[model samples]
Target: RAAATSRRLSHSQYASTTSGGPLQEAFAKGALKPGLNVVLEGRPKQPNDVEGLKQCLAEFRQQLAWVERLDVTLGQLTNVVESVSQNTTDKDAVDPENDFQREMSFYRQAQAAVLEALPRLRKLKVPTRRPDDYFAEMAKSDQQMQKIRQKLKSKQEAMEKSEKAKQLRAMRKYGKKVRRSYKRDISMTRMWSLSEELRN
Candidate 1:
């Protein structure tokens, strides 16, 4: 009889407290505890009352099982959300590969421009007689500067080629004598003679 009454009273309490903020607050703070009662004192229990008590206990256990399942589902959802967020952030932080490719592309363009200018540079003219005084006579415009630079580059290349040709000719002529003179490098005297001949 007591257990049956207790269940009924508990249901009534749940209904009354459903929209009560203080009741929820108290439960959260552990000021309330849920329980099932079977009897109060020595008394012959009613069969109908025992059945009612059984029903209440069954319902309470089922509600608890539902809450536990919801908790587990929520925990799994939180882990999935955290993993997705980290992957997105890491992708944003990563640098792109195209930056290196873009730099290499710029370098290739610069190299091509230099190679294409070389042939045009070779045919340009420069006066060899007044090498030091040429800059003073050249005009100070972009076109004039470019033309002068091309002429100077061509003259310098021709001079270097001519000098190399002369060296090869001299080596062919005196190479046998130079080798017979010493097993080591050419002596100081030979080097001086070579310098004077180049200067002349």
Candidate 2:
């Protein structure tokens, strides 16, 4: 634009300033230094300086064309960048592997929990062996028990003499079965241990 405006204005300004026309020829002869003139290196002296104007214009048009191509390339680059960014966003929103990964992580946590509880499971396990003196240790002291026949004879004598003893025996006609009917709060593991010890 600067080149075009200067080209046109130089012609008009010269025409206006040199209306007398002889001053124009004298100024040309003076060989003044050029300022802001769009000069094409060569010109046709005989026909006119018209060829110089055409050359300068052709060069300017070529430069403008190069600028237009750069703008087109920049637009294409912007579109490519936008497409890549949109694809990345879509991938982040949903993916098939995420569910599988979460399930695997949950399974891993369950496995770790089981592993951590192994020592407690071992501690809860019922013991298989009973000591050699188990029955000896379980028996009452000698004062609490004597020969079975002798004890029974004494009991029978007492029951016959004591009215209270006779009435107690009559009331207990169901015998040990009534005591067996009641439930105990003992755990299965403890029962298992007892049964194992008494297996012999």
Candidate 3:
């Protein structure tokens, strides 16, 4: 009896706390009842971090105006689009299914980009060409490459030698068969002449 009374007191306290809401009015009218699945609203949201947002925007603007500024020409973009449109119109001239046309299209676009970019880079005073005295380090040492070439050459030579040997063996076998057949034919002819001479 005491436990039942404690539960009723707790339920009344919960009901009082949720009294003014539409859900409580629905419960009062016996239209809807609260269950374990029923969810209540959480606490209101906290204020946004305005200072942090300002700092982030300032940083973004600084980065955008950095030493290496990005410049996109509307004219160049339009030219590229026009070129693509023209290329598409001549689909019959260059097969759409062929990879050659696709590759060529990419090459032309890249060429145009390079042509446009070079002038801008020069204007910006950026180095557009490598120095004559610039030396590039190769992935493999000269000695290692030479060794690889030697190995490949030796393999090729071995293959050629084996092929020659095989051809020679086949020729010797064929020649031996031909010599035997010729010798047999000659002996038979000689025997025929001897038989004729005996009869005479």
Candidate 4:
């Protein structure tokens, strides 16, 4: 009997909490439903960080000023694909396999960019060409270059030697053939002279 009484009290406590808690208030206001599986929309919006935003804006302005001072920003280049599509009526002009038209469009765009950039760069006094006194370091060391050169020279020499040996062998074979023919001609002459004497 005591166990039954305690179980009833626990059930009543759980019922009270479920009925009078914040969830019940939400359900009463139609913000929550009993059986529907849906996301709640009554949550408050996140507060913005005003100080953090100000800091970010300040940093962006500094970066913009630096870029302006350097005058490195070329703004935006014209879209080659879009321009090609607009200028040409052929359906294949924009196709990737149509390399000629695509390449020509890119070339024209690059040319235009160079033409536009040169004047601006000149006005800003930016150096467009490398100085004559500037010297670039070679990618390969001098010793490595020398080894490559030696290897190429040895290979060429071997090729030339092989060609000369081939020519000599061919000449020797031709000389042997010539000598055999001359010997045959002498023997035939001798036999013919003997036969003529016998007939006389």
Candidate No. with top TM-score: 4
Please, what is the whole-model Cα lDDT of each candidate in the order they appear? Answer: 0.60, 0.56, 0.73, 0.75
Q: Relative to the unseen true structure, what is the C-alpha lDDT of residue 144 in candidate 3, on a scale of 0 to 100?
A: 100
The digit string of per-residue lDDT tens for model 3 on 1-200 reads 99999999998888778744666665666666347233435886988999999998888875454226655333334443444456565432444575765566566667776787787778878897899999999999999999999999999999999999999999999999999999999999999999999999
Clashing pairs in 4: none
Candidate order by TM-score, decreasing, is 4, 3, 1, 2
TM-score of each: 0.20, 0.15, 0.37, 0.37
Task: Name the lDDT of candidate 3.
Answer: 0.73
Residues 1-200, model 4: lDDT tens digits: 99999999998898877745666667767777556433466897998999999998988865454326644334334465555666656533466676875687667767776787778778868888999999899999999999999999999999999999999999999999999998998899999999999999
Q: What is the C-alpha RMSD of each candidate to the true structure, in Å?
A: 31.7, 40.7, 12.7, 14.1
Off by over 4 Å in 3: 1-135
lDDT of 2 at 121: 50
User: Candidate 1 residues 5-70, lDDT tens each?
Assistant: 999999889877776665556676666656522233468675678888988888886545422342
User: Ten residues in a row with the worst lDDT in model 2?
Assistant: 67-76
lDDT of 4: 0.75
Residue-level error in angstroms, candidate 2, position 118: 1.7
Worst 10 residues of 1 by lDDT: 67-76
Candidate 2: lDDT of 113? 53
lDDT for model 2, on a 0 to 1 scale? Answer: 0.56
Candidate 2 regions with alpha-carbon error over 4 angstroms: 1-97, 126-200
